[model samples]
Target: MGSLEEDELVRMVRDFIESESPSPTNSSSSNCLALSHRTQYLILQDVLTGETSSEAKVLKHVLKHMKGRRDTKRSTSLRNWLVKNLKIDGLRASLCQTSWSTSLGCPAGEYEFIEVINEGENGRTERLIVDIDFRSQFELARPTQYYREMIDSVPVIFVGNEDRLCKIISLLCTAAKQSLKQKGLHVPPWRTTSYMQSKWLSGSRKELENPRNDYTGSAEIGNWVPPMVKPRKMDLPSASSALSCQFSNMSLNCCNV
Candidate 1:
């Protein structure tokens, strides 16, 4: 993301964080939380906009294949296809299944997403989380207009490092709590920040190995037809530009939930 676009998103999230709460007695606590959130948001922006990051390259290919696939297919099937195709393209990608036991009032659950491992400079390794349905993970049953717009601005396909994903989960979970409180509804345990963090952070990750001859009988293998006639490299900018436009006009609007 560009600096201008990043700043705009940060500002919008800040406004929501600093907005008045239903309980004025917790104003001090809310201020502290807002400060922490702002710090994490800035760190996340830095991680996302790193010029030397290999995530962009992997993400570009992911988006290309995703755009070329049938939308009716389930995410699991899409993820499997992506893992196979990415490996064929010489990228180390795999299906990551994360399962965690219930803790601190959060229920036990398992989540599956794609992950790409890249060997960075200086023998460093980077893990990128590629979530196809990222935005829906933060969705609420009923939300204020501002909250709805904020969540809607999140990219449908999220490609970021673990740190970036953690910060995003934290920020969104906090916002979810605020939105539910504003609606005079109870914040479910599943919506807690800890639960959200466990989904991607604190879990046993089992990477599914790519099978040999997996693509032999698949009709979708090695024959992706893009929806439009465009250069593979050029697709990234178009996708980012569309999301940037959405973030540009994002603003906090008061509404009864």
Candidate 2:
């Protein structure tokens, strides 16, 4: 099994490179193919996260393939080939909202924001429920893969200025560049932005603005809303008294009798 796996891996790499465009047919609309050692490292970072396999193991394989080359100045021609550019609106509410990346040992959820707190000098915190989408039971281990990790042993508590009090999780904005360097590939500094925009900062200013509701310059600070639950219908039980009755004849007051 191990030998077969190794052979399969080698063949795949060989085919991946051969498929690249070897020669250009036109200057304006050129059909060309090219890539570098560093590009593989960058892809490995994204693939490792989405997959369940160990990142180190996958990284090792990618590095092994990128070696034996003194490649330089990766062509930005691939930049024009990007298809289906997607930019998410952070302002929009998601069915599932998450504070920390699930793999980083944080809550897994699509929970509604209970409230956004802003603490100016002290910091920020977000108070939310583990399973408050509709009912508590719905947020169990099935969808979120919730474990003891979800509950958070230490409640991330903070009490200070209400200006920057909302919970904000910072993420790797340039993690890919570092990942490439670790695997022995050096890309130019300018190419950093082209590789990938940090996912966290892609949202708009209002969406990214200190999750804190505090706005020293604007009136929106006071306009912050409190949770408002919608009204629901309920069934009323019919009047029935087997033990005691208002009627004198039917009344059976066994205890008081």
Candidate 3:
């Protein structure tokens, strides 16, 4: 990779259009530019010692020229122009992973497999499923004391007592329920109550599977919305024993503004 003057680069692009050096295959010239050619050209910039302030400024100016054309749909493609060139050859990274023949006991894309070569297995992989979500709920101290009474007082850090746990369960459930509504999906009527909240305390003196103290009361902004959109949860083979979410079961197995 070496630096060519900005004007030289422009001239090269024009020459590409004239000669059509990389013959467009099934894709249109616009498609090639947006998706592939653009990426290819950006890689070309690396050859230059863009480290200099003057170089950066010039580069910025050239890029600005493209921005002006962006409003034109033809100008606003995915790859910068260089990327389009990359796709013309055998340079494109496969869009997704390949090489695993999933087992009959599994479904496609359902199980995640990671490559591991150990214990005499050359390309062995382990099936893994990870489910996690922003959690807000914990016990409050003083079972006999109502939260309103203790509201003005310093909040007990952790240890949600039965009553506090009840509230947390209620609020989290409500929050989840409300959030599901916002996602344009419906939580099933039968499972709605369970998803809303559950109280599973073993006995007194023990601890609840208490969540952390960070209660956003809102969804962690960009975090995935809970996947409560099960078209049918009970019809599956494991329905009788299933009591958890398919998406964050931590069996496994958020919010507002």
The numbered model that scores best in lDDT is 1
Worst 10 residues of 1 by lDDT: 20-29
- Candidate 2 structure, TM-score to reference: 0.15
Off by over 4 Å in 1: 1-32, 35-52, 68-70, 209-257
Which residue segments of model 2 deviate by more than 4 Å? 1-115, 119-175, 182-198, 203-257
The CA lDDT at 12 in model 3 is 55
What are the runs in model 3 whose C-alpha is more than 4 Å off? 1-158, 188-199, 202-257
Candidate 3 lDDT, tens digit per residue, 19-99?
322111111233223222232233223211223332233234334333433333321122223122223322321111222
Per-prediction TM-score to the true structure, in the order listed = 0.66, 0.15, 0.18
lDDT of 2 at 163: 13
- Per-model C-alpha lDDT, please? 0.68, 0.25, 0.28
**Candidate 2 worst ten-residue window by lDDT:** 78-87
List the candidates ranked by TM-score, beginning with the highest: 1, 3, 2
Q: Can you write out model 2's per-residue Cα lDDT over 6-121, one digit (the tens) per residue?
A: 57655544443334331211111111112232333222222223322222332233233223322321111111111001011111111212232232222222222212222223
Clashes per candidate (backbone, < 3 Å): 0, 15, 32
Instruction: Give the deviation of candidate 1 from the true structure as CA RMSD.
Output: 24.4
